[model samples]
Structure formats: C-alpha cells, structure tokens
Target: MQQSLSRGSSPLALLMRGVSRLNLYLAGFSAFVLLAATAAVFCEILSRLFFGKSLVWVVELSGYSLLYMTFLGAPYLLEKNRHVAIDIVTEHLPPRLQMPLAFLVALFGAAICLYAAWYGLAVTLDQFQYGSRETTVLAPRSYLLTWVFPLGMVLLSIQFVAQAVACLKR
Candidate 1:
C-alpha cells in the first residue's frame, strides 16, 4: 500500500521539482525585465517630451526586454497550465480518454519545443562564431541576446515532458 501510494513520487517528480524552481526564477527575472522595460519607455517618453531628445538605446532595449520576458515566462506559464488553449472539445471528452489525449498533446508540444531549442542553439552558435553584432547604438553581440531563445525553449521542453509524465501518472 505504501509503495503504491508512493508510486507517483518517482525520480521524475524530483526532476520536476527542480525544473519548477528554475521556472519560478525565470518567471521572476522576466517580471523584472518587464518592469525595467516599462521604466525605460517611461523615461524615454519623458525625455522626448521635455528635453526634445530620447535615448537611442531605450527603444532597442525595450524590444529586447519584451522578447526576453516572453521567452523566460513561457516555461513557467506552461508548468502552471496558464498558456492560452481552446479546450472546449477536450473538456467534454470522457475521463477515460482525457488522460491519453492530454499526454499525447504534451508529447507533441515537447517535441516542437525540443526542435525549436535545437534550431535556436544552432543559430546562436553560428552568429557567435561569425561575430555578429546588432546594428544599434548599444551594438551588443547578437548571439548574447539570441542565447535566451534556446534557454527558454529548453526549459519549456522540460516542462512539457513533466506535464506528459503527470498525465500518464493520472
């Protein structure tokens, strides 16, 4: 009975816990990025209105911050089952079929995320190897910003695997 009760407490649960923590951190960081972007935009607006000038980096940085925030928060959103989904059909399905369907969906999502992560890493590496830089006032290395894509996708893929396993265990 104890073993059966503990069946759900597998190594996957441990991995999920770690991944959950990481996602939480990423989500918090994303929130900070969002706040910073808001501040930058506000500052730029004020500067332009009052001083007839604006920081060139503000617009570029705000765009990058928005991108970073979306990517970083995505894994956490997936883990929390907060992403947008049209589940009218699934919700009406019988309980017997629901788990399997959910598992399959998660598996498909994981596969897509894994592919994206691979592609993003390849692109970032190519940029880094070729010494690519953004054509902006800040002019940061493009690869440095691009690295967030693979990192976020990897996290999202892990969360999807966790979701699939949870569905199976159901």
Candidate 2:
C-alpha cells in the first residue's frame, strides 16, 4: 500500500485500497466459480450415467464460468507473483537494473490492459444496443458476459499500475 497513505485519510487512496481488497474477494469468487463448475460437471455426468438424463445448461454455464474465473483470478495471480513469465534476460540482470525493467514491463502491461478494456467496453455496449443473445443452450444476453471482460481488464490494469508504482519505489 505504498500508494496509499499511512492513515488512509485521502479519498482516492482509500478508494484504491478498498478496490485492492475487493480484487482479492473477486479472486475468491472466481475460485468458487471453478468449484461450482466442477460440481456441475460431476452432476451432469452422474445424471447422464445413472438417470439417463442431461442438464442442458451445464456445459454452457461451465464455459461461461471458465471465462469469469480466468479474468477474475488474473490480478490475484499477478499480485502474488504467480503469473506466468519468461524472464530469460531479467533473471540475468543485477537487482538494481531489475526493478526498472519490472517497472517498464508493468507499465506496458497496464497500457495493454487499458487498451483492451476500452475496446471490451465498446463491444459490450454494442452488444447491449443490439440486444444480442448467445445462440447456445441458455441464450443469455451477450452483454451480461461481455461486461465481465471490460470490468476484469480494468481491475487488472489498476493492479498493474500498482505493481509499477511498487517497482518504482524499490
């Protein structure tokens, strides 16, 4: 929380702190979504095998859950240093040079995510305007799922900015 005040008296700092905390909660929700998807798969298998029945929505919902899980959990993974990386050059550099490199990488990542978020929001808005729906089992509104992409991207961008700031401080 280097970006945040010690007493957290500032409104922007407080809001960002709250958002960071919320990101963790969202990651937990993402995990729950995965667990639920697993249970759903099991349920579908059991129903089909034992009762000769099928849950038509199981596969579709599971696919949607996968998308949600990935986006929602990404920030948590990055924050924890668990995100995938190919640091062939960075690992060879001295500690002094590494922080700046990390800072640059984080800024680049933040920029990309922000760009994607902008396009995602636009796509979602277009879907909403068209009242689009998936042609799959549930035929759910397209915007319902599309909204998550922009939201997740924005959260991820913020996380990247925070990481960049921390790296700069080092």
**1-170 per-residue lDDT for model 2 (tens digits):** 33532235687677667776877898999999999999999999999999999999999999999899998888777766687999999999998899999899889999999999999999999999999999998999999988989988998888788788888656
Where does candidate 2 stray beyond 4 Å? 1-7
Query: Judged by lDDT against the true structure, how good is candidate 1?
Result: 0.86
Model 1, residue pairs in steric clash: none
C-alpha lDDT values of all predictions: 0.86, 0.86
Cα lDDT of model 1 by residue, 43-161, tens digit: 99999999999788998998899879989999989877798988999999999998899899989998999999999999999999999999988899999899999999999888777
TM-score of each candidate structure, all chains considered together: 0.89, 0.90
Count of backbone collisions in candidate 2: 0
Model 2: weakest 10-residue lDDT segment is 1-10
Model 1 steric clash total:
0
